[model samples]
Target: MIEVLYFAWVRERIGVPRERIETEAATVMDLINELKLREERYAWAFDDLTSLRVAVDQELSGFDAALAGVREIAFFPPMTGG
Candidate 1:
């Protein structure tokens, strides 16, 4: 199981802050596809990948990042510096 965390508007849209998901996805993009299939909320939250940023095990990563042996994944909007 991988711990999936949603932040900011993503959390609001998904109606949850985090969840443990059992998945067979081989990559982060694949995992996102699984999420989008689960509900409309997920699809809405993930609709614009360009506006989102991802992390695997607290380290920044890309959508195509491999999910092999990953224990955590986080999704949030791109951060802007003040």
Candidate 2:
């Protein structure tokens, strides 16, 4: 199972802060696709990949990043501050 976390608007859009799910996805992109198929909320939340950032087990990673052995995955908008 993978613990999925949502931050900022992502949380608001998904209507949840986090969840643990069992998936057969091989990568972050695959996981996002799976979630998107689950419902319209998920589809909208992940509609624009370029506007979001992802982390695999607390470390930044790309959509194509492998999910093998990963325990956590987080999705959120890009941080902005000076």
Candidate 3:
């Protein structure tokens, strides 16, 4: 099982802050595909990959990142600094 965390607008859209999922996905995108199949809320939350950022086990990562040993994944909008 992996802990998936949704932040900012993602949390609002998905209607949850976090969840534990049992998946056999190999990559983040694979996991996302599984989620999108589950419900419209998840589909909307992950609609645009370009508008979102991901982290694996608290470290920033790409969608192609392997989920082999990852225990947590976080989704949020891209951060901007002034």
Candidate 4:
């Protein structure tokens, strides 16, 4: 199981801050697709991949990144610098 965390509008849309998911996905993109299939909320939250940022095991990564041995995956809007 991988811990999936949602932030900001993503959390609001998904109606949860985090969850543990059991997936057969080989990569982050695959995982996102699986979630998108689960519900409309997940579909909306992940609709625009370019507007989102992802982290695996607390380190920034791309959608194509491998999920092997990963414990956590976080999704959030892009951060702005003041």
Candidate 5:
């Protein structure tokens, strides 16, 4: 099982802060594809990969990052500096 966390507008669109999912995805992008197939909410939240940032196991990562042995993944809008 993987712990998926959503933050900022990603959370608002998905209507949840987090969820635990059992998946067979091999990479972060694959996981997003799976989620997008689950519901429109997920699709909407992940519609634009350019507007988002991702973390794997609490460290910043890319969509192609391998998911093997990963325990957590988070999605949020790209951070902005003041």
Candidate 6:
């Protein structure tokens, strides 16, 4: 199981801060497609990949990044510098 964390509007849209997911996804994009199939909320939250950011095992990664042995995945909006 992988720990999936949602932040900001993602959390609001998904109605949860985090969850444990049992997946057979090969990459982050595959994981997202799995989630998107689960519910409309997930679909909306992940609708625009360009407006979101992702992290795998606490390190920044892209949608095509492999999910092999990844224990955690986090999704959040892009951060802004002050």
What are the per-residue Cα lDDT tens digits for candidate 5 across 1-82? 9999999999999999999999999999999999999999999999999999999999999999999999999999999899
Q: Which digits, one per residue and each the tens of the lDDT, describe model 4 over residues 1-82?
A: 9999999999999999999999999999999999999999999999999999999999999999999999999999999999
Clashes by residue pair, model 6: none
Candidate 1 — worst ten consecutive residues by lDDT sum? 73-82
List lDDT for all candidates, in order.
0.97, 0.98, 0.98, 0.98, 0.98, 0.97
lDDT of 3 by residue, 1-82 (tens): 9999999999999999999999999999999999999999999999999999999999999999999989999999999999
lDDT of 2 at 3: 99
List where candidate 4 sits over 4 angstroms from the true fold: none
Q: Give the TM-score of candidate 4.
A: 0.98
Cα RMSD, model 1: 0.6
In candidate 2, stretches whose alpha carbon ends up further than 4 angstroms from where it belongs are none
Which numbered prediction scores highest in TM-score against the true structure?
Answer: 2
Where model 1 places Cα greater than 4 Å from the true spot, the runs are: none
Residues 1-82 of candidate 1: C-alpha lDDT, one tens digit per residue: 9999999999999999999999999999999999999999999999999999999999999999999999999999999998
- Superposition error at 54 for model 3 (Å): 0.2
Give the Cα error of residue 69 in candidate 3, in Å.
Answer: 1.3
**Model 3 Cα shift for residue 74 (angstroms):** 0.2
Model 5 misplaced stretches (Cα beyond 4 Å): none
What lDDT, from 0 to 1, does candidate 2 have?
A: 0.98
